[model samples]
Target: MEGVIDGDTRALLSEDGALDWCVTEFVRVVDARLPPRVFLRHCPELATAGSAGPITPSATPVTLQLLGSDPRGLAANAEQAISQGVTRLDLNFGCPAKTVNRHDGGASLLRTPERVYTVVGAVAEVSQRHGVSVNAKLRLGFDDKQLALACAQAAEAGGAEELVVHARTRREGYRPPAHWEWIARIRAGVRVPVVANGDIWSLEDYWKARTLSGCRDVMLGRGMLADPWLARRIRHWLETGGERLSPTPWSARSDMLIRYADAKRDAGMAEKVIVSLLKQWLNIMRGRDSEAAARFTALRRETALAPFVAGLSDLGSSSDSTSSGTAAHASSTLAG
Candidate 1:
């Protein structure tokens, strides 16, 4: 979610009232302490009076996420984020990127529960001093699934207000069939609330995951990427105990894409970057829509920003016919 779940994506997801809160892309913590501008740069929501970002027609609160190995450096950075009006902070211990693991950050920490405890403890101390909530997101383990309980206990011992477990080891690396049973084990072991994550792409998946993991709360990542209204649908189901709503039409999604583009433009991103991001989203959508595949194939080669935008505009006009069909297809596939 590093490059994918940027400010624009958060704003786009917020449009449907699906997200209760969002965590920003991890701010890398190195040898030196980063300035407040660094946090704001990653999460522009800090500049908003309510510490929320413009999510189309609404605003959603955002939590700042930080990644690092050093206990003190992360703690110091947490202090900086809070000073800038960040109310919630999340520690990243679940990232599986090779580059991040090589640097002794992210899921690599799973091998050393002592270090995890130290890091989380330091940040929690700082957060407590300022009355801010500190949470941790972690995978089951590094390469050993058995170590998951120890890691969860470490996080709880270190004072993590809540723990989010992405039910796979670092070695699994987004493979199908996330091990949600581990989340149930972690929940039983930890005193803090446990939120389950991974491979929840549809309402059926959500129900299965909730039952398997024994978790009422979930954190949607890729599922939200594929379906923006996922959270709204889940919320509705929880409230009314009725059948899940049908997926939003692809035509409606085109409007969201346009809004996302406008958000990036408003944030001063270059047109090329915006185009690249759009293609990235479309590629993810291609998993569910043949029309998206065709559209991405056509627009992937366009280099100029204006032409790319115009092409999207043209595609948006004709998306209605395929919208419902595409949504049904995605839902059936995911549910299956």
Candidate 2:
């Protein structure tokens, strides 16, 4: 979600005011405190003065996330983030990227619950003094489920106010069947609230994840990218007693893509770079929307920003930017 979920994406998804909060991509901390520019780059919202900390335009809170292995370095950086008005912080211990693991950050530390305590304790100590809350994002364990409970308890003992568990182990990567039942185990074993994450792509997935994990809230990552309206969809269903909204029309999706392109261009980003970003987002969307898939196929070879956006905006390419009876699959295609 690092490259995928940026400030613009957070703004668009949160604008509907359905999501409780949004989190920035992880700020990779190492053995020393990073500069303010680095923190601001990862979370531009921090520079905005409105609430206790960074919040989206709609006032949805934005929690700054940090990822690192060293306690002292992480704590110093945590202090820097607090100085920048970040009231809520999330420690990322669940990233399964090979590069992250090779560097001894993220889920690599899950092998030792003690290490989890040491790092979390360091940041928590800094946050508590500023009246800030610290949260932990975790996978079940490094290579297995053996230490899931120990890790959860260690985080709580180290002062994490809440834990969001991406049910699979580090070994599982982004594979399917997220073993949500494992989250149930972790939830029952921890004192703090546990948030279920991974594989929650639709309203049905949301209900199933909640039912299986007994968590009151769940986190959205790629799911939000695939279907920008996922949070709103779930909220609508819950508020209406199982009533389902019509599938998000293709025009809505295209409008978002075009708006994203315009935003990057306005920021002075190169045409090539903006095109690449749009392609990345469209690729994720293709998995859930047929119109997006067709547009991606037609525009993938394109290099210019204007033409690529035109391809996304064009609704006459046989697919016609219409659901055409694929709405059911887009909304609830996966089977348990």
Candidate 3:
């Protein structure tokens, strides 16, 4: 979720109650300890109550995520972030990016469970003094799934309050059919809560994952991006046993994009960057919605935020134009 789940995206998702909590994109730890400003840069929510921000219609607390191999440096930075009012810290051991692994960060640490233990232990020990919670997010293993049990044990022994298992090895690289049974095995081996993650794109997928992983908690990443109402739908289904629901219509989805753009603009992101982010979101949505694909095809080249907003406005207005009367009314109701 590095280049993807920024503050704006988090706000958009949180506004609709899509997440109970969010971890900011990884703040890299090198030889030197990072400053408080670096944490603020990644998660501006640290400036708010309970390290929370107004997620539009609602608010959700965000935890600071750190990625690195150096236990001391990570501990120091985690301490600084905690001192700056970050109430929770999540260590990133699941990122599969080649650049990050090459630099001895991310999933490469999985090759050595002791390093994971040391790093998590160091950070947890520091945060525990301040009554802050520490957690770890991990893949099954580096290239082999057999190491997952030991990895979970390491994280627990190192004082992680909870563990999130992404149920895929680094080599798997987001392939179809995430192995959630591996998460079940890890959950059985560890005493801490194991939150299941990976390949959950719908309510059905959520139920399937919960059954396979034997986990009550689940985390959504790309799935949430593909369908903004996914979490809300899942919550409703869990409460009401409803039938599968369709995605939000084009007009309503367009309003979310507009709101995201306005939030970014208000935060002082340049027009070009805001436009690029909008296009990125649209591209992701295009895979699931034909209208989004059509709109992205029409405005992918736009370099200014004004034109992008105008294009979205046109897309929203015309969404019902090509539909039957009944469909047009449904779209109008959704927009309203």
Say which candidate scores most in lDDT.
Answer: 2
Ranking the candidates on lDDT from highest down gives: 2, 3, 1
Tens-digit lDDT track for model 3 on 81-134? 877888878999999999999999999999989989999999999999988889
**All candidates: CA RMSD (Å):** 4.5, 4.1, 5.5
Deviation in Å, model 3, residue 334 alpha carbon: 24
- The lDDT of model 2 is 0.85
lDDT of 2 by residue, 130-202 (tens): 9999999999999999999999999999999999999899999999989888899988888898989999988
Winner on lDDT (2 vs 3): 2
Q: TM-scores for all candidates?
A: 0.90, 0.94, 0.89
Query: For model 1, how does the per-residue alpha-carbon lDDT over 1-336 read when each residue is reduced to its tens digit?
Result: 657787667766775555667778899997578987798778876777354422223555677889999999998888888888888889999999999999999999999899899999999999999888889999999997978999889988998998888989999999988999889998988889888899887788888988999997888887776777677777776766565676566665566777788878887988888888888887777676665666778888987777776666674434445322111111111100
Which runs of model 3 end up more than 4 angstroms from their true locations?
50-57, 243-246, 315-336
Query: Looking at model 1, which ten-residue stretch has the lowest summed lDDT?
Result: 327-336
The stretch of ten residues in a row with the least summed lDDT in candidate 3 is: 327-336
The true-versus-predicted C-alpha distance at residue 319 of model 1, in Å, is: 7.3
Which candidate do you rate higher for TM-score, 1 or 2?
2
